[model samples]
Target: MNEKLKAYRAAILHSLADPSEVGIEQSYQYFEDGVLLVEDGRVVKVGAAEDLLPTLKGVEVVEYRDALITPGFIDTHIHYPQTGMIASYGEQLLDWLNTYTFPTERQFADKAHASDVANIFLKELLRNGTTTALVFGTVHKQSVDAFFEAAQALNLRMIAGKVLMDRNAPDYLTDTAESGYADSKELIERWHGKGRLHYAVTPRFAPTSTPEQLTLAGKLLAEYPDLYMHTHLSENRKEIEWVRELFPERSGYLDVYDHYRLLGARSVFAHGVHLCDHECQRLGETGSAIAFCPTSNLFLGSGLFDLDKLERHGVRVGLGTDVGAGTSFSQLQSLNEAYKVLQLQGKKLDPFKSLYLATLGGARALYLDDKIGNFAQGKDADFVVLDYRATPLMTYRLQQANTLEEKLFALMTLGDDRAVKETFATGQSVHRRG
Candidate 1:
């Protein structure tokens, strides 16, 4: 009954669990005429409009008709420095890194360039309805500082860290193990847990980092156990072979991180496209996570992710755009690619499950599920409003969809940034379509 509370009315939907694991009925919550009440940057109440309206006297109501409101999309893995180089033609993982990724990332050494790009990158994310992301910065410590600076300005809940690489990269991009550790420690002290921001311990990958640098990265994680550890895994076969050559004494690609004490509950490995069953088992047992980046995988010709296999093995998985190599920033489009990737393997990614991966499932992967994933009481009020009729084709398709399932399927299959009517973070509107 506070005057500060704001009420948003729309058709609401959010995931309770992975539908592939739990049945759809138990995994999702949808309300046709829902009212989400927000106050002081948190969700105060959520229920049928008719039921809550009587109790919300004197509150400002924002009406969104024929729109679907869901928890804001969370990108589990993305490279913030690669925003400018997205969609570069040809080349798979390793080559793509050297040619497009490295050259673009090298520019981040300039503080102004890093600041400018961080502003653009976060705006692009807000435009696409992504409220939170696990991001990667360049090797320069300034890049991480710049990114967190921009994010802090907007009061956004974001996670990012500087790339740690001391070998197998251009001289301009490499940092010594000691320098990497000191830089990461300094940045973490400055930014980690500063309001809504968090820090990630980022080792680019096993091949790019020497054992010394990786050991230091593991040391950082051991020191800050609550912080996140993010890096690349078996994205491509050649890359895996290179990792084997780099750490020949190790049992495998995943073993390199395991041996260095880098595998744990707070760790997230991107693009586990060719991971073996043993690797998956280890990931599950250690409470680590895999970020399934279908858009990047298909664009770079990396192998298809065995989503079904990973799930069956009890591995926690989430969705990512993996920009630069990834084709789109839209999580809906990411879901579209995810659906196709599974289809090629004769498996199905349910529409509900795809949305889950983009939202709650991703939060779970980042170990932030209790804070930002759903419309649970007292959670942060970050969400997106989707215009089901954003496109002429979507309008027609939605007209014929009678059931909620069919309507949701059409939205995921046809939606993109154009479908995002508005995006909000912590009960404040950040981007609204004209």
Candidate 2:
């Protein structure tokens, strides 16, 4: 690799493991004045500035004074096609989909419109310091193609798939079982494993896909075991009831996918707010993951997600800004909502754990932990630079913080896009705050 080496100097913070598994101090790595060395888009070394600076004598060094550097936030689940309709008028999940989501997604059938939204959506993600996400595209193959094209241009590590909804959706937004399978296969071949891009086989959910469509989706998933399976689970009570009505033969909503062989280590279901004990056990045993969309759940009147219960069952969970239903693109804002949601459940979400969910936990949920999460040597050099004194309120609050925990608490509780001073992808500066 003949790539030039670059060194970044700043305060560094990252999670090495789940706080629950290891104590806060053991799982958290922080250096007051740190230096991260990168070459060919991978971390070469990370440690105290005094230790690494002397070694990087000839490398280019970029310094950010008093800023906190962390792994770029990972959104475990988000709908890229819903960029235009985020924060639509309040409605329940099913109604919200019909009133706002389906219609907005229908426009993506036009490649030009798809490309336009793709660019804007990606920039918005970068602006919010989210370097990676498992995104949902529209039913149109062009939408997924356009999204991948935009991400590839920026050398971003993105996972996306064209949605498959063969029934229970508008004609313009649906595809038959045969067509859905074929389209997903074509897209998988064209985009999966290309540079930093990967493809997930996306079936909208049990409600949108018929029995035949679900079976075919299962076949596609089985064919490419490495690809991710993205879909919804028991997000809303009404949606769950409707799924039971549709697949009465199955014991529960999650069983519908399990019966079709879609439950696995690579499957990541969104909005598992109302799942039962059996569902949680099944998800854990299969190594499946859930993208807990607190903002979207709260916006759509979905029930509270029991993080303690999920963890007790050994189920893996990550945070998502399920945009459109979710109100913000910023993971810090998402963490803000997650904190409240857990509070309502009579549980306290620790500040350290909150940061873990957006970084390492999200990568673990997507089964990409080995590649992108944290500042481990040989990992991809994707991270964010946060300015603690970004706003007047934060500047005042941070002055009172004397400990690292206190500082991180202030960042998650009070920070947003303005806190993101810069975003880096593969050792390159992708977005700098203007």
Candidate 3:
């Protein structure tokens, strides 16, 4: 029998458990001098350096000295087609979709364009230290195919779907109800659970989907066990008003999805800022999570999300950089911006809480906590190693940090892609540099 190759000598720091389950500080396990043994694609063992270092016999070692290692950031929501339209001029969510998003998404009908964007999108994600994401694709079926194809090549755990907007969108972007479900189901059968890929049942928003179209989306969700549902909900007051006009028979915005049975664990609704108290309660009760896209909310003049209020609603909240609308791709930047977003709401948000939202919080939202989002024994070794002194300012700032939290706090506020020293996925070296 052939001996398995091994890579050792990597710093190990990961969420020990659900921070929400055990207060944030206790939830993390960081080994100052640590070692991870990787064989094949999964993490075989992780422990202290003194114990693991001695086992190295003819094995390669990646020693990222003084670099802080943590699980890769998980983005709960983003639009793959919006890669080119991320920083377009000022407009609210609805208008932004019409002027920038719809026009940009329409181009996905071309397979070449989709493939090109897919490649660039995945590169940007890896560069920004994001290992997993729930992405939105154009209504074109090719868009999902291209995105999944790119993710597969990169070996990323990506969740995305074909947008379904049967009405209330540009004619070019809209698809018949039948075609939307069929294409989505086919994509699901092909990609869901296929080598780190998961398909999301995507509806642009309640206003754009007819009762029948939404019902069809709900049907798809019911049929596919373990599949995720993605959509926009109560993002803006104007959009909520439009939804009210569209679904007046329902009690509120969330009710539309609730009635369709789309409110449950693994259902991710982005930009839930305007959700009422009752709506928040429903989301919490149903176990549906909200992706708090602080950057996009601020970029589009969207209202600040009530994270404190929503968590009280028992809603699991995660972070997102609603790209294009979201000012940056780096989850570090998202954490930085999320701090200010909560600050503006007169809430006291500690930096650790911010980091938790980006990492472990997202894992919980996606229900992938058991697998990714942390570095534990028997879990995938998906983490990014960051240089505390990645830049001149960060190097200078390191002097002020005496403790781990202080160092991490400085990193979130003062870091970007340049801070990523190395990135690893499933025990493989995907990005390495300082």
The clash numbers for all candidates, in the given order, read 0, 1, 1
Model 3: weakest 10-residue lDDT segment is: 1-10
lDDT digits (tens) for residues 1-434 of candidate 3: 12464554545566665454578788777777887776666777778888877777667767776677778999999988899987899797777878888888888999999999999988888888999999999899999999999888878888999999899888988998899999999899899999999989999888888888888999998898699999999888898888888888998899999998889889999989887899999999988999999899989988888888888778998899989799789999998888898889787667667767878889989998887877656677787888877898999998878987888889999999998887778767677663
In the order shown, the candidates' Cα RMSDs to the true structure are 0.9, 1.3, 1.8
TM-score versus the correct structure, for each prediction: 0.99, 0.98, 0.96
Q: What lDDT score goes with residue 59 in model 1?
A: 89
Candidate 1, overall lDDT?
A: 0.92
Order of models, best lDDT first = 2, 1, 3
Off-target runs (Cα >4 Å) in candidate 2 are 1-3
For candidate 1, the 10 contiguous residues with the lowest summed lDDT are 90-99
lDDT of each: 0.92, 0.93, 0.85
Off by over 4 Å in 3: 1-11, 18-21
